[model samples]
Target: MTLLIETRELAVAAADSIVQPTSIRVRAGVPFTILGETGSGKTLLAQAIAGTLPDGLVARGEILIAGRPVQDLAVHERRALWGREIAILPQEPWLALDPTARSIDQVAEVYEVVRRRPADGARDDAVEAMRSLRLEGAGRKLPSELSGGMAQRVALAASRAGGARIMLADEPTKGLDAALRDGAIDLLREAMGSEGGLLTITHDISVPRRLGGEVAIMLAGRIIEQGPVEDVLQRPRHDYTRRLVAADPANWIRRIVPERFGDPVIEARGLAKFRGGRLLFSGLSLTIARGEIVGVVGPSGSGKSSLGDLVLGLIRPDAGSVRRDPRIAPLRFQKLYQDPPAAFAPQLTIRRALADLVARHRLDATRISDLMRRLRLSDGLLDRPPGAISGGELQRFALLRVLLLKPAFLFADEPTSRLDLITQQEMIELIVESAREEGCAVLLVSHDRDLIDKTADRVLALEGSWMDRDAVA
Candidate 1:
């Protein structure tokens, strides 16, 4: 086997504080995978290799691409290696996409500009890629118009557009359905092709299990366990690795559903909405009672978010109406966004942002400390900007702020899609517990049916023209 990318004693740090020293090597055809919880430095490792680390972070040690030493390379030299030698699929890739650019155009631009393909040929290749990913219908839609899953596919197309030999993929299945996830994985495997290499960082255990080659478990910015996938995952050695594997939701049998109920918090009747040039839903009626956990499960772009927005009155229904409790204020209704970074101010630290919210709402400042302790967040994280923390960490902060408002209803849209299995379980547990205590009506949307199965009291399934409701006992 030939080596494509190698890092020796590679370490990342902020100012003088170093996280951990890591070394990884990718062979010509085998995929190297890293599995870790959020904020465990998995993404930082990939970003270090790609030379795309966030602001205030620095990398040290040796980096080699295609047997060429590049750690000390100039900015332009390192940048020049992109597209031709190395390509990266960023976490939350949708955020990297141009909001105004059409999906196809974004992918095609990589071919035309980076690969130097002709305009006609670039577009044709992009079209083929999109078609293969089942995104043929989203070519003309803007990134904003596309669902998170569609945006993810589009990003994959763009990354592969340049035909890079060594690819670094971060959370490639962040927001994808199982079918789409398989397709994306297949594409990644194809990209490795005998002569190419792949380095993947993901929280999804199944990704490494299926890809199969080598796996490393990262914890607190260090690789605690590294070996063959089966050996590391099935017969784990480290205690943390053992807990991580055992924490998977797949192992859960069933969740306890409470019998206590409250008055209706909101009601929707004959609701209809047209989106993405199609009828999302028609004559849809549902009511959520206070203290109820309503789970919404659907494929991407199947109108899960749209339905939440409609019920929240963020958007007017085409043919029906949503009615809320006459005594409750509109501010009592909150939403936990799928993309955490987009929810906060880039210029402010977490502490400042939370304080501002408290002042604006006249909320008790003590609530922040109480909630932070419950969420297992450190006071140190509050001093950092939103972009400085991990997505999962930021999401917990989002939930903390929303809870401070004492919301009557919360629409959590794929709140755990980007989180590790442990974090996902913890957040859902907090949400359910809070609903019980606060009498908050929760309309939770997720691509993971298992999560919906465990956390939701009543499950609402939506995919295309299909709609079904079932009570979990």
Candidate 2:
């Protein structure tokens, strides 16, 4: 089989080297994955291949597509080639999508640009592609109206519609639930069969295993090991790969000692929520006693986030009521939103944002510094705006902001979904420990069953306004 894409000692650098000299190949009709932890330069390599590296980043070595040297091509030539032969599924779909345009139109535009098809024909193809990824009727909706998972599918639909020969997907399933993730994997597999080759970069180890591809383990910008998926992941040769495999959530043991709970700090009774004239949920009831950690688990778009908003009084319930202890002040209730970047002002520096929160809460500088240290954040990070930092860093900062308030009740909604396994474990441990120390009742809304099992004292299975007790740990 002919090689679809090949990198020969390809290196990328910005001020300092980001990706070390690396060589890799993707054959036609095959899938390959690059696995690495956060800030390990996997994304840089992907960007280098796509010729989309940000300004100030320099590329060295050679990148070939269908036996053509991309480096030798003019800017316009490279752009034309990219439109026809390559498509990128970005790490953050929302960033890639235009908020003003309808999703379907955005996807159809790709087909029109790359395939030069008629508008009507491109529209039909775009809709068909969306349907293949289970995104029916999502075409008319603007990106702002779609959920994180829905937006991801839209991005995938656009990539598929582009009819590119090689696909580069970066953290394709970062925010999706298990079912959606599986659907995405299937779509990518289908694309591989049609598109000739697929290269995926992700921190999620399960992705490579599920895609059944060649795996390349990246550490500190270097590809330290490469082989079949099972051999590389299961029987890794490098210490870094072995550590990553071991750091899988499945290997982590829960050591949370059960503590007795007091009276309810926050309670929701027969709660109901509606969106877009559809009932998201109704007749849901739950309680978070003081010092208790209650885990809420459900499928995507099943109102887990809605329930969190209801508890936090961010959204009014259509029915029933949410009550918090009268003694607990309103400021004592904090929410850690799922999209950390959206929670802050984009133009404001992290230091300015944290300072405002600190001043509002009358918190001391010492306490803020201590919290930053605990979260493994550096002092320099405070100088950058929210958009300038990584998702994981932004998430940690968001958590730090909420924790500074020393809330009596904390609502954490998929707080660590963007973090790597090791960081996820660390954040979970810190949340549990801090919440316990402060006697703060927590409502942890997540789709990760292992995470819930490890952190929650009790679990509630949510199914469209109904809550069933899954277990009491």
Candidate 3:
């Protein structure tokens, strides 16, 4: 095995230093992973090494790629190596995909252009890649038409298509279900055969655990502790690392089913939804009472998010009806979207968006500050556009927006999917507390079975959208 990437005392800074000086090595046939929460500067460090840092921020120290000095190379010289020698898979899937392009075209473009393969051959290779990831049926859909999970798969396929020997995957498993996440892991592992290198940045501790690599624990912009994955994850020296491991849902002490509920806030009767030339679910019936947390779980593309949409009336069911309590205002029925950035105006700062809501609704302005504190959002983030912040932070901002409106029936679709284990637990706890205090009905959808089991009152299990298996446990 050879050294693929090495950063000696690499650090990134803006008005002030963000990612503190750090050093690490990525070797062929071995995975070197960085584990940290969002805003902990892990992503910033990766961006610096990849030569994709934002305009204002600057990086210092040495970066070597395959024994060549990356810093000394011209911009074009460095870019030519992308997808040929190394590839980057970003944290947000939407950033990697183009809205106007079909899934197949977006992926095939990499092969035809970057790899210089023939058109027909590129298309064939793209099709094969998507088929392996169970995205064969979504090839014709635009990036906007795909689900979060599907879009994520498309991004993975496109990134891996160039056959880059060195791969930098940032939160690659963030939006996927258990099965797809495992499939992605297998794919990355196979791609890094004997002489390839992998560097993954993720909060899902499971990635490093399964990938078998050297792991570093990062907090407050610094690597606090690092060693073999088994030692760092299984036995920790840092207090933050131990807390992060303990916060994994698998380690959570299961609570008994939540207390019984009261009157129904929303109900679905014999509902049927047809999508992508297939019936997602049929003859499905569900009811969420005020203050009750109902969990929905299934494989990727199996309609977990679709079910929430049905209940929210964002999309009408092909059959049957969704009836909301007549007493509650329509404005009170809100949703925390799966992708937070999609819900916000890109041009407006976070503060501007919230202020507009406050002014329009004639709501008290002081509540905004209080809720920001509750969500652990920094005052500085309020000034930046949605695209400027990390996905996890943007997600908490989404929750703050929804909670401000005081939703009576909240459809939380994978709200915490992009978050770290520590923040994930905190987000769930906040949701539960908000639901109870406001008598809000929550339809929470998740890919992790343990999470659904721990938080939901009763589970709605979907087996490929067949409601026959929709049994409450």
Among all candidates shown, the one with the greatest TM-score: 3
Off by over 4 Å in 3: 256-258, 465-473
The lDDT of each candidate is 0.86, 0.82, 0.88
Whole-model lDDT, model 2: 0.82
TM-score of each: 0.96, 0.92, 0.96
If the candidates were sorted by their lDDT against the true structure, best first, what order would they fall in?
3, 1, 2
TM-score for candidate 2? 0.92
lDDT of 3: 0.88
- Give a tens-digit lDDT track for model 2, residues 1-473: 88988999999997788799999999887789998876678888998888888777888999999888897677788778665688889887878899899988899998887889999898888877877766654677888777677788888888777777788999998877777788898788887794488999988887898999698988779999998998887787788777777777678777565657777998889998876555777888898988889898876656788888899898899999999999989998989988787799999999999888777768876777888888878897899888766787899999888887888899998897777777777788778876678788999987687778877898987664321211100
Report the lDDT tens digits of candidate 3 across residue range 324-372: 9999999999999999988999999999999999989987788878877
- The per-residue C-alpha lDDT of model 1 at residue 283 equals 86
Error of 2 at 216 (Å): 1.5
| For every candidate, C-alpha RMSD to the true structure in Å | 4.1, 4.5, 3.5
Query: Candidate 1 on 1-473: residue-level lDDT in tens?
Result: 89998999999988654449888888988889999988888988888888887778899989898899988888899899888889888887657899888888888899999989899998888888877777857887888887888888889888988999988999998888777788899889998899999999998898999898899999888999899999999999999888878778777667677887799998999999987557888988999999999999877777899999999988889999999998999899999998888889989999999989988989999988888988778898999998888887898899898889989999998888878888778888889887998899999998887778877889987765521121100
- Shift of residue 165 alpha carbon in model 1, Å: 0.5
Error of 1 at 440 (Å): 0.9
Write the candidate numbers in order of decreasing TM-score.
3, 1, 2
Give the clashing residue pairs of candidate 3, or none: none
